[model samples]
Target: MLHPILPLILFAFVATATPGIATTLSTASGAQFGFRRSVPLMIGSAAGLATVTGAAAAGLAGLLLAMPSLQLAMKIAGSLYLLWLALKIGRAGPPNLDVTMAKPNSFFGGAGIQWMNPKGWAMGLGAAASFAALADGPGQLALLLGSTFGLTAAVSLSLWCVAGMVLARLLKTEWQWRALNIVLALVLAASIIPMWRTV
Candidate 1:
């Protein structure tokens, strides 16, 4: 079956291009650890989002949506985790913000976060609902969603990471670095509001 590949690519691009929890994490990791060390974060983010989108395509999202209590619990848990991350990121410095800190936001961290990310859920559910029908079967739909979103996410997040790396070079002072961290943390924390309001 011809899988509307072009339209799927376009849709995936738009969804992944928008800044969200994953992008924010990518940018933060890049700024803190530089592009090379942060590669895992970007890759894991792409993979995690792909998994989420694929699972949603496989009917997990629908099951969650039908369970109001479970969904609310997930939202609360996700919000708390994001807030904790924001607090930690907000407290940045010179020596303290080294590549060693990368452990917290390594590949596993990036992938784990997406499971609780509202933006990931939004995009995954949206894509599953919008594009799943075009697929020939559940397995094919999951594969299509995963592959398309994964590739687009990789590119989009790499750009975000690069942007953060560039911005880091411009920072001459500790205060400037701290300020950027604070701003990123705030934006990441703030990302929850819009999605929370809808729920």
Candidate 2:
């Protein structure tokens, strides 16, 4: 039997290193909202990653995959949500002056992106399935897989956000920030293709 913990470790490191829509959005969040404001988005992303990983480990993702109509539902919901977010971000008038006092963008921005991100689903499901296949025992494996993936996602995504924050200084203007957000939103919207194709 495979060393039970190795798969979790591999999943954590690999998932964190792989750039996904959440990474892009987190980077954008850090740039636009600063590291503090980006917290909500990051948290959201981590939650989404955990949810998917848990679902997969528990066999829910496989069931969802087997059900054609359910898969279609998820695709449609995710695609439309992305489109809505794109429109909202594009129309955002200006950054509030009291941004520092405002709530972090980590919650919705981070989490919402993960829910709509097909790549996230793929990673979570793939990792969980591989772990399940390798495991010799069944006790609490799902919990272990979920926790490992979730913690890794949070840490990994935070790094991306911080990198974005560090790079924000290079932008040097409000227009650049706005333009970046628009572009990121558009990218997020465009990422729905793989999910659509699968459906």
> Each model's C-alpha lDDT?
0.80, 0.68
| Candidate 2 structure, TM-score to reference | 0.79
Which segments of candidate 1 are over 4 A away from where they belong? 1-3, 95-104
Clashes in model 1: which pairs? none
Predicted candidate 1 versus true structure: per-residue lDDT over 4-80, tens digit per residue = 67788998998888877878888887778778888888888889989988888887887777887877777788888
- For residues 1-199, what per-residue lDDT tens digits would candidate 2 score against the true structure? 3475775787676776566566766776676578777777777878877777766677676776788787677777778876766665554423553243244454755666666555566666777666775555433556767778778888888898888777777766667767766786787677677667653
Cand. 1 Cα-lDDT:
0.80
Residue 54, candidate 2: Cα error in Å is: 1.3
**CA deviation > 4 Å runs, candidate 2:** 1-4, 91-109, 116-118, 133-139
Ten-residue stretch with the least lDDT total in model 2: 93-102
